[model samples]
Target: MSNFDIRDLLDHAAAAEPAQPAPASADEKEPRLSPLAERMAALPVRPTYSPVIITGAARLADIAVVLATGYAALAIYIAPNHGYPLSYLGLLPVFALATVAALQAAGLYHIGAMRSVLTQAFRVLASWSVIFLLALAALFFTKTSEEYSRVWLLGWYVSGLAGLFLVRLALGLAVTRLTRAGRLDRRTVIVGGGEAAERLIEALAAQRDTGVRICGFFDDRSDDRSPNVLAGYPKLGTVDDLVTFARRTQVDLIIFTLPITAEARILQMLRKLWVLPTDIRLAAHMSQLRLRPRAYSYIGSVPVLDVFDKPIADWDLVLKWLFDKLVGTILLVLLSPLLLLTALAVKLDSPGPVLFRQKRYGFNNELIEVFKFRSMYVDQSDATAARLVTKGDPRVTRVGRIIRKTSLDELPQLFNVVLKGNLSLVGPRPHALHAKAENRLYDKVVDGYFARHKVKPGITGWAQINGWRGETDTEEKIQRRVEHDLFYIENWSVLFDLVILLKTPLALLKSENAY
Candidate 1:
């Protein structure tokens, strides 16, 4: 729609595309993904802390200071013994809440503010003073001045301020250490080189503590056009290389220094870059084109077009991980009897291993071994999934048929969801390495196939619940599955996951395609 923003348009454009580039075919001399993997492996993997986690910790720290000091002040000065009554206890919470609200309103919890001791102290003192002023106002209105001691209120205010400074001093030292180690800062990689990138880099650097640490540049131009090194950072590689690099390590932000007017290059870059789970920003500072102010978010003073954002990121990632761990463990415990019975069934029916471990594409297109109860005979086990198992297929044992039909064979992947930390309880289903439909590899049959991996694969998924489970015997079947997968990814939430999970039992009843 014309009214939609550029980011929304770019995001949907790739998914709507009929076809996109696929990895090199088997006939090619060198495979595409192997080299990408090798290149990624060569790069050092660095730790990255989520901004949400950092900001949340800062908020908790503020609340802890106010609440702890409020209690201490109450205990020290006529807290209960001479409080005129037990009424002062109620006011402690109000005072603590007021101080925290004041500090939040002052924006003292922002990443930029957290990095600076002077900034935090000045802001904290101002906010604390304002709260105390308000508390005095409340006390005057309530005529409770005669009831509580002035020393108590003053001590609470001063002690709260001191607590804030002490806590933040420790946080400040930690921030400095994290900054030095590239943990706290957003590890950024500029996608374009030249004066535009140099200008952007200089602008960020000028701000000193912009909270973004430039990792380097990734440009498509030749060395003459775009030098190997620019603005004191090396040109790591091209946009294609950037994707591989991101898979290897944590790349928090991807900024395109190229002006917005370079639509073709921007779109091209986006086609490849959209698959990454990182913030993608198109720097629009030099572009003559402008949209409403709300359309852009700034990095320091540089204006940037908000493009694709990583899905299930920050707190959502944390929450999903927690949910998987908690729920998966419970489910695993509750179903231990069933799992044991199934394992015994598989062992008795077929002389193969009780569990099957097949490599499947996981989050960020990385291979994660998925566990399943062995559903095929030992000699005929299709590890690569090169052939589709059909109805009355000879390889399918009697127990395998029942488990596969009932979907109990996938229960062991609870380990993947719980212990391994690679799979989610509900997400796009990860496919075997050589999974194919209609004799064509999934990547070749569908455009943007790997895009489904933007989130961790799950044992159950939107596609599975929507009649897209079981065999993918045709290209159309896989396409529909991928479509459902992308839809689930775009609209994911805890509630959505719960709904899909609840509907799974009913969906499993119609196992006509399960074989």
Candidate 2:
């Protein structure tokens, strides 16, 4: 296993150059993963939540508290005044949003804010008071104070403060509980070894509440140069193996301890590691190239340069997930009749099940069973998709031919998005493991093909909408598809997803390439 050569990623990048992976370990007969490596890959990991999710939750809770308190004050105080201006109702959401903005500016939204209950309380109180003061000053300057009730304002402010305290207390307890359960910690691994790695480790250790838990090291150098163990963490494997480990375990962060001056090695490492969907950072504590303060982001007290971050992560992931579930359910319900008709067509046209399940690569190289309306004969079904359906292919049934062209065959992938949650409604299309273009595997025919896997695959995608869908029989066809996929990933947004989805039906009308 140690003697086997690693895959030369550079060759693939150099122009879709043909290459083969190193031979498998003799006993295990595994090409990429060995027996021990497979076991290590399956090592249990504690749950890790995004720090943004925690802070965002705090902001939402704070906003809710303020809004609810203001409304309650309005209901209680309005009777005494016989009736205050109806315009005051419009001020509620604005005030709540402003309060959250103030808290965020005061750093109350930081993940570490709840680490100390007293400190959090003080910060929240100070920021909330300041926002109220500002609001009062604004009302006075605008000469609108006469229209509003001082008594109502006082009640609102005081009650809002009390509500904030309660919410913060609950938030603090939740953070404390997560901390105790070790669910808040990010499982991290250092990408280099030796003195640089030690310095980075020590710097991280000096800081509190960083939530960074070092797992091990990975360096390509021999044991003499980069020791097998450094600073109490074992050298897990080489950078080549780090990719596999990250894919299997879903590691959160990969910090490179190599000096910034090692540009060549850093670039090389990135060429290989960029395929994994993890935050890749460079430790800059020892670097002399100083940038502006805003250019650097800190994890605890350790400043680092962010090279690459997990895409559609944190809040964006939350939004996308919510979009998928809510919109997916509505679409599924609305399209139920169409889906049933398609199922019946397949059932009557062939003596096979209505849904065809096939394993395809998903996020981070995980295999997922994608459901589609069975389009081909049962005896002639291509589960591995070794041979892609071609125009007028003999294997396709009468029902399959029409559905495949119209994309009705793919409607069942909504089950994948809504139920399985492994796929997005709009992203790169997933392909079979052995899917080929020009008789070569896609990875061999397109440079940086796996980089598309950085995000979850979709039923419909930027490529599909832009005329890259359907058969990928030639290298040019697959290459163009991958290029569009990468472009969508780089410029992903909710709006972009919606635009692609809107164009999907139109794209299906022009099925020149589809089998």
Model 1, CA-based lDDT = 0.81
The TM-score that candidate 1 achieves is 0.87
**Which residue ranges in model 2 land beyond 4 Å of their true spot?**
1-23, 26-39, 79-81, 84-87, 133-146
lDDT by residue (1-515, candidate 2, tens digit) is 01111122222223321122234577631235433344445656656787789988888898889889998898898755665456788889889889888887887887678867788789888988898888889999999888788988899989998999888888888888888777788778898888989989888888888988776678888747687557765665678778877877758899998988899999999998898888999998888899987888988888899999989998899888988888888889999999999998899998989999999999988899999999999999999999888888999999999999899999999999999899889999999988999899898898678999999999899888888888999999899999999899989998898898888889999998887
Worst 10 residues of 1 by lDDT: 1-10
Q: What is the lDDT of residue 394 in candidate 2?
A: 99
The candidate that wins on lDDT is 2
Candidate 1 pairs with clashing backbones: none
Per-residue lDDT tens digits of candidate 1, residues 1-515?
01112233233333331111236777853223333223333545556677578778777877787878877887777746765346777786787677778878988766666778888889888988888887788889999878777888888888888998897787777777777676667778898889999888888988965668776677878646687557766565678867877776677899998876688989988998888878898888778887888888988777888898889988888889988999899999999999999999889986879999898889987878999999999899998888888999999999999999999999999999889998999999989988889889998899788889899999899999989999999999999999999999899999998898889999999999898
Global CA lDDT computed for model 2 = 0.83
Total clashing pairs in model 2: 0
> How many pairs of residues collide in each model?
0, 0
Tell me each candidate's TM-score: 0.87, 0.90
Reference-based lDDT, each prediction: 0.81, 0.83
